[model samples]
Target: MKKIKTSPLLPQEFVVENISENEANIIAYPFEVGYAVSLAHPLRRFLLSSSQGYAPVAIKVEGAKHEFDSIRGMLEDISEFIINLKSIRFKLKNDETDAEVTYTFTGPKEIKGSDLSNEQVEIVTPDAFLATLNEDATLTFTLKIYQGIGFVPSEDIRDELDDGFIPLDAYFTPVRKATYEIDNVLVEDNPNFEKVIMNIVTDGQIGPVDAFKNALEVMYAQMAVFNSEISVAAPTTVERVDETPEIKKLMGRIEDLGLSARSFNCLDRSAVKFIGEIVMMSEADLKNVKNLGKKSYEEIVDKVAEYGFAVGADLSDEVVSAVKKKIEAE
Candidate 1:
């Protein structure tokens, strides 16, 4: 009969491959079964819905009272012109609040994003077409550029609009696309581990690598809401003193403990590098470390006991007594 392996493993590495300035592939490997999908789905949602960007939320065209109206000499009607405005991406240079941008063009000529005059805003898609005008005809318009996240319908901001301002559906997320795929990967002799391959594409306003990082940050912030302190009915507290001689000896490097790879990595990643630190942590605290399972926790407890120290024990008197006895024998 074959034995079953029950412990979980942390991903070995997270690598970002920049495919282009605005596209990237993020890879993480050696996750336990089903963990890849658990991580990738939420990240995909956050990347698509939480990224911030600027878009024209409202517009007022000269010679046009509403979207249904038409402007003379303009090749595109008011509705078509507004749709073109949605394609022009804006990047704010500073912390300025939302503001109105105006453009005036005379034809015979073609109008583009370059025709807009705004020092605080940069047109990322400057070559984007707006409309064309006939000879001696003039086109004028004002756009209310607003910074926001995800897709917001015009009706959501309708109450905030003033008279004659045509509300628009805003596409504010800079992430153009986000997707992920999972594949079976081998870890040691186990064939059930998985890997995640995520592809991200962003608009010119943000880089793909930056968008990936921001999505991770968003996921972290959302998870932090549930990272509250775990309360126990009777908590075991181990006070540590750095000045005592035996305690100082206990502060020796954790590497000397000869812990298993999984146990040692869990402690190292948790920043518990000293034997003193490990001795001070309760079983519950050790269990809280990412990927530290019950088996690894038991291994840590047994290894620490070999040194005549107990995890989460009141070591003030017991440690001093053990050190003195060992010194006398030496």
Candidate 2:
């Protein structure tokens, strides 16, 4: 009988080695022989079907009552015009779930995506062709833009639209393509490890790396549902002491410490108002505060130590909450 060697169930590292405007190549290594395929397949599916994007859900074109109607002066019939509208990529700049865009043209001129105007939505494919008009022809249209995920058939929105509005089949995924390849790799004298290489492409509305990350988040959300009922008790290493009085003293206003203007302003801008918040924060967390340089961080640490407390002190949640409530009452 042959025995299998022990290997890591999860990949050791995931790195994006190659990236461009709308495409990215990500590689994950040292996954157990079959784990690479297991992880990559679901991620690719999520990237294609779960990523959010914006598309035109319905449109009202002047001189055409329905999708099959023909309009004079336009090179493309109404149906062809609808197809062109489907290819235009968009992104919502605000929190709006939907928006309206209007375009009007009088030509012998070519109609492009840039002609559609909406303040809340950004047209990602400004150069995309929509239609052409002959001399002395007029074109005017209004599009109902919607933010959604996956494919939404026209019939789903047809009954909701008012008269003269033609509903469109919306493909709202920003990921244009997603694929993965798995290959065997050597790890720790073992040759059975697998490496996964994922290639992702997105419409200009979203970057490929962002799309890949969104897919990973969606996958995590789906898997987390199974773990909802499996809560495990956290082990306690030491008994906690009552230090509510000491913590309350530390919870006083930060201005009482007399820190320099630069350090004080930086802490204020970061929304840190009390000395206890600063004392509990680690050096790494302090470094992340905007405009707080090395000198300011060192000064803060020294200042806290002068008060008989050090940064990164671990206080029990009950003590911290009590101190906060006492300070608030004052």
Candidate 3:
């Protein structure tokens, strides 16, 4: 007879396996990663659409007619240069006015992002070319660099004056890239048990751990307000109720009510014994008894509603009116 080797069971947790340069791989054991995966989308969106950076917001030029030779090409070159600038992250040393800096560029060469740098601002991508000149062109112009979130137009940030203000849209997105992947790794001697690998990547500004933390913070904040709102709409009182064994069995198992695993687990053991009173209490009041969040309360409401009852259905018109009036007075 051959003996089977027993392996130690791994606890559910998150572990960073590798981090190289700008990317990192992490492992989360026995996690219902759908929750984490759902959060990843918002993290990426926040990184790309909400992160802060600096860019050129305004520009001015002189010493050339509207239709000078190769002026169109020069404008196109500048456009491409600005597009590249949008990708670079800038570090601001001191607060500066939105006031523009006047510079004379007699360019017979390529003008780059570094050329715009001053003592207060340092350009990370100095090699980026803003414009190229085939012939000598004298251009005296002001560059207005400012810090902001997302792509903000000059009109939205400052007064719209027709003072030769070339309104340029500024890009401040600091996130260069973000991606995540889920993989299943078989545990030793336990082919049936697997660990979930959640790999994440981001720009140097924000690391994977920080991003995940922020995402959870946002989700919890929203859930807190949402839970409060739905609870106030329905209030319940705790009272004894007589029920037949059949009715008790029908509501015995929280899972039988089509509640999610996460929400079902949040219910206290006492909840099973008080199912009758529970279904009659407002969801807001349930927070006083059951240790659950907004999602759990919502699930309970859905389950109760299916049986033609509500969390606060037992409240009389007089009680409901009083509660409403009290709430308004507050």
Give the count of colliding residue pairs in each prediction: 0, 0, 4
Candidate 2 lDDT, 196-243, residue by residue in tens: 999998888789888888998999788776677987454333222344
**TM-score of every prediction relative to native:** 0.67, 0.67, 0.49
- Candidate 2 residues lying further than 4 Å off, grouped into runs, are 1-9, 232-330
Give the TM-score (vs. native) of candidate 3: 0.49
Clashing pairs in 1: none
Model 1 ranges with Cα > 4 A deviation: 1-7, 229-330
- The residue-by-residue lDDT of candidate 1 on 214-246, one tens digit each, is 888898788675557754344233222234566
Candidates, ranked, lDDT: 2, 1, 3
TM-score of 1: 0.67
Pick out the ten consecutive residues of candidate 2 with the lowest summed lDDT.
234-243
> Which residue pairs show collisions in model 3?
231-284, 235-282, 236-282, 281-311
**lDDT-better candidate, 2 vs 3:** 2
In candidate 3, what are the lDDT values of residues 1-330, reduced to their tens digit?
533436333334457755754456656554232554554566666656655556667655553322222243355434454465455445565665344567666657677767866776666667665667555555566657676667887568557534554556777655455566555544322334445444555544446656455545655565677785566444232222233443443333345567676656666454442344555466667766556777677777888677555776665554444433322221
